[model samples]
Target: MAIFDDEPRKKARPHEIGQDLSLLSVDELS
Candidate 1:
């Protein structure tokens, strides 16, 4: 039987998501 990769990855926490947004803002402005 072939093993299936069925488990979904967990979402990032609020702090991590915020950090990503900040990085995106910097890139857009520059």
Candidate 2:
């Protein structure tokens, strides 16, 4: 699926750390 492919792209980039942090905070808060 497209979703599965997109996940690895995000994980592959170090620059994605900022995006990951934002998502992680929201996940933790909820």
Candidate 3:
């Protein structure tokens, strides 16, 4: 239910948001 709402919000700004997420993921892993 809540997941559905979050999906569109991300898809709405995928390019910018996606890049940030990728960086965060890498930093967290590193």
Name the best candidate (by TM-score).
2
Cα displacement (angstroms), candidate 1, residue 8, comes to 28
lDDT of each: 0.43, 0.61, 0.61
Error of 3 at 30 (Å): 0.3
Worst 10 residues of 2 by lDDT: 9-18
| Cα shift from native, residue 19, model 1 (Å) | 6.8
Tens-digit per-residue lDDT, 1-30, candidate 1: 122221211123344456798755554454
Better of 1 and 3 by lDDT: 3
> Per-candidate RMSD vs. true structure?
9.1, 5.4, 5.9
Which sections of candidate 3 miss by over 4 Å?
A: 1-19
lDDT over C-alpha atoms for residue 29 of model 2: 54
Alpha-carbon runs more than 4 Å astray in model 2? 15-30
lDDT of 3 by residue, 1-30 (tens): 879866855665555455797765554454
- Candidate 2 per-residue C-alpha lDDT over 1-30 given as tens digits, one digit per residue, 9 for 90 to 100: 889776765564445456697765554454
Clash count for candidate 1 is: 0
lDDT of 2 at 4: 79
